[model samples]
Target: MKIPPHRYPSPLGRCQPEIMDVETTKRDGWQEQHILVVSGDDSRLDFVEREFIRRLGNRLYGGKRHE
Candidate 1:
């Protein structure tokens, strides 16, 4: 079975923010001053711990740029 071009919808008309965000993030690594929004009931213990440590360190020593 083959579908005609007229029957197939073009992807450019689709608007999916989450898909775009993931694609952009993959292309460019995460940056500072950006709000990270996580969803779902999955456990995020490790991420929480790391984020807490980073914030605490920054607060104590000020913002230090790491290459």
Candidate 2:
């Protein structure tokens, strides 16, 4: 599911992609947080970001805590 930099679309309609690195740091040891980095066109970035968040949220909080 990882898209290569060269295959990413550009801001102007062409492929102007780049590299993206993501890292996560925990704070307070109670709440969960995430960090995302993207180096590509902003066109489909929002949708992709939303999907990532949605999927992560579902995985983290969708099920019962004790289950």
Candidate 3:
């Protein structure tokens, strides 16, 4: 899944610090699946989220870059 970067406001209507939550779940006798939740300032989260997506994509697709 691809997540577009977006800002999340606090209860007071102010932008809050960002948090990226990554969860991996495995069902019985099944392969594990991943879920990623991204919340925060769009600018800040964009870079981080893009990096994560790039790395994951590379790994999954057997790209040359790995770091």
Please, what is the whole-model Cα lDDT of each candidate in the order they appear? 0.58, 0.52, 0.54
Residues 1-67, candidate 3: write the lDDT tens digits: 9898897856875566556433332232134334443333335457778777667766766676557
Per-residue lDDT tens digits of candidate 2, residues 1-67?
A: 9886676655786565554432222232224434444333445568777677667766866933674
In model 2, which range of ten residues has the least summed lDDT?
Answer: 21-30
Q: What is the C-alpha RMSD of each candidate to the true structure, in Å?
A: 11.3, 17.4, 17.8
TM-score of each: 0.29, 0.27, 0.28
Off by over 4 Å in 1: 1-45, 65-67
List pairs with backbone clashes in candidate 3.
none
Model 3: how far residue 15 lies from native, Å: 49
**Greater-lDDT candidate between 1 and 2:** 1
Model 1 vs. true fold: TM: 0.29
lDDT of 1 at 54: 67
Clash count for candidate 1 is 0
Best TM-score goes to which candidate? Answer: 1
